[model samples]
Target chain A: MGHLSAPNDIEDLLRTLSPQVLGALVRRFDDFDICEDAVQEALLAAATQWPREGVPANPRGWLTVVASRRRTEMWRSESARRRREEAAFASAPADIELGAVLDDSLELLLLCCHPSLTPVSQVALTLRAVGGLTTAEIARALLVPEATVAQRISRAKQRIKASGARFRLPPEAERSECLAAVLHVLYLVFNEGSTASSGATLHRVDLIAEAIRLMRQLHDRLPEDGEVSGLLALMLLTDARRPARVSDDGALVPLAEQDRGLWDAQTIAEGAALITHTLATAPVGPYQLQAALAAVHDEAPRAEDTDWQQILGLYELVRTIAPGPMVTLNRIVAVAMVRGPDAGLRELATAERDPALTGNHRVDAVRAHLLEMSGDLPAARDHYRLAAQRTLSIPEQRYLAARATRLAPDDHA
Target chain B: MKYLILIYSNPQSREIWNSFSRDQRAAGLRDYAALHESMVASGELIVSEALADPSLAKRVTSHEGQALVTDGPYAEVKEYLAGFFLLECPSMERAIEQAARIPEAAFGLVEVRAIMALDGWDI
Candidate 1:
């Protein structure tokens, strides 16, 4: 593998080093905008030189030094016009100590997850600043307009600066709230990939992989946080089933119909171990509960053995812990599977009346399935068509459209 | 760097301020006083003031080498410039820091633009 200088290997190395280098520079220099730019410059420098000269022995340190130097130059130019509060940066130490450059990804995460920015801004900035992805790359993968993404990232940075959010972890009293913000951002990334909101494709492996990579980093930085492990485990186990989530022709495959043989055993084992450890301590966080739910499904040898009763119990626990219409929707499905379609319909009747879920496509989709299960194919087809029209995702529309068609009767003259 | 800090207030914003209770309005005004005091102490505050509502404003425009006067603020714009502060700050970030401190900024918008120094002019 020494001679294997694959392009992907270098990209992966740079991705890991970029955030650490950027985080280190931000901590040292206290300039979010300048640190981000300098880090990008350093990464560009590495990409040009590393292949020809062989990878550096200490790439992270090398990038840190280069970015620090670049940051100093930026200060020099800005200060030339006018003296700034950070004027001391001109004489930044030449040898940036390796030890002083702590891996403050937590700090970076907190900064990127600053509450002042909108959620879309937070996601865009998190992907660029900490995920080490370029705006074009992010736009391309997520299918957002490049201009929109660029504007969002810059605006988010300005908001963070203007709001005066410190580029460090919040004090102990507020740590959990800030941590929750960070976890929410990571989960958004994961969800966007695992189930894309709108796009030609059903799934984006690039984004899913990036989310998992960042979660692994978060887990490493925060080993004691059971929720972190829980999130990572949940992502891994869910991703292990990705291969069977879609058919060869790109049709959606429901979990019950997926081929168990297609699930990645190694990933499932790793996630199962993490969840087992997490549960030994009784992790009551939503992520842990979801992981436990996924684990039960993964452990089942066949679809009929899914342990729906246990899943129903877990769904109830999730509702109690984090009550929301979405959880209620999931529980409604589980009830249908465990008890009967009529039971599920009864549970959803309230949701149908609730203003929040009255027009929700997912609720409609679930209702369509329950109706189909209860032998009301015509009503199921109508609801499926309603769901197809309501969803923004092209793939989801196709899936629901197919469902509606499957329920249609044979046309006879 | 000298920055032109433009403070924009929507006429509708008055509704918000009016909706506040007497104590809430007092607290907001107190916060503004503190913000103004700090900026003045830092010597970054050059000139600042609040403006009357847009209904009391006028506009002048020239077309085809002729001057034309119009009533009210620019009709094409939803948010007219309500007031401004000319600030001599060290950097853009510092200007933004000051802009964010403005009490109205939270309720409306604050724009920080660098004041161009043409030739030897300095303020």
Candidate 2:
């Protein structure tokens, strides 16, 4: 497990309550900007005031009152500036009581992903609004500038307001597209967590945990959606093997070399059941295909017994829908195992010619392994050197360099 | 959100593109057209246009209070603006996805920028 900075109880309490408090405000006022700001202020207030005073008997009530008042004040000041004196939200919410507000995290996530925003904005807004991440936290997670994330979120909110997007879920006819957007963001978070784009650590487990938690919550709300279950299954199956994915020294372990006994059986079973159920419904979506692929790997008790042929077929399907270098690389590896090294080399040569994989470390790593397998130690050494040069992770660099060094004693390949 | 998709063509990409077979060029155009049609169907495309050849270009400048115009296809950069698309998308991902689907993006580059505020012109 990656190092998880265990959030203190206070931050945990606030994070848990954020969606509910913000949901209530949005439901009552329907002003995303004002309500969001009000709720943020209220959460900040709770962060300070909650510790000073004993926990309130009615925490939601306290938050509702504070956020509502803040929103009302904002509405009043804006109307005054315009000199319109709008009747709506003119008075403070002194008498308004905290009603039962549905957990609107899923709804809020969908709202943040409204089609008018770009993918970057959707991810930023979702992390801020539903994930309750500060802009700085989001910036760190995305490996981008704080200012850029701030601008994207601000612009997304403006676009949402201009489009008059609804806070509630869309109609059934439009639900599929909206759901895809929601799943895409979650998947992105999962990918980032599984393999961080840069820096020392190979994983960002916090994001993985966050995404899984959110997906679990979503599954609880909409259990019937096969794709939802499929996505959750995919994430779980992938996360299940993470413990065995790294060595004691933190170097990445290839799937074939990983200790199979260390894989989490409970998670694998849960994910397998979900994938089986989802696939029974004849769903052939990206998540389902990926989950099926994971299942094929997890079902094998030993690396030698892995269902490479099944995985190869699944990869072909995945490539048809989502053609990319990484997927092709995996497929190439599978082909190498099933057909032979030469067959894999033929496919990999085509992939090497692809512009998408130019200078990509994974591609070079695969090339080195295939060349080594084909009894071409000199070429393998050269490719390993290239692989070491291409990667950012310290562990990956060491691993590739070790391979290069093990192959040849002299500097010349 | 509204995005400006800028299509850029560099001399290297231009050379590679010009070396394509006629059928390959036609296939590239077909892909671009298909991508545009899909965006139109999804209501994500607000406007898109391919710029005329830069060889017929004119440059205009303003000094103090006078309008100055110069005629020539002259630029100092290896990359030149080839075309653009103004799209009202739901997210940056969609805009980028659309931009990447542009045929020239295979050899050149496509950059997507979100407009800050719509104070001028009409949506």
Q: What do the candidate models score in CA lDDT, each in turn?
A: 0.79, 0.78
The 10-residue segment with the lowest total lDDT in model 2 chain B: B114-123
Q: How many backbone clashes does candidate 2 have?
A: 12
lDDT of 2 by residue, A198-265 (tens): 34433333778878988898898888888899899999998999888767765667677789999999
Provide the lDDT at A25 for model 2. 76
lDDT of 2 at A314: 92
After superposition, candidate 2 runs with Cα above 4 Å error: A1-7, A81-86, A90-100, A143-148, A196-205, A351-362, A391-396, A409-413, B1-123
Going through the candidates in the order shown, the clash numbers are 0, 12
Model 1 alpha-carbon drift over 4 Å, by segment: A1-5, A81-90, A100-102, A196-205, A411-413, B1-123
Residues B1-123 of candidate 1: C-alpha lDDT, one tens digit per residue: 468888886667767888999999999889878987765544456567877767667777899998797786565566777788876555678799888878678875789887532111000
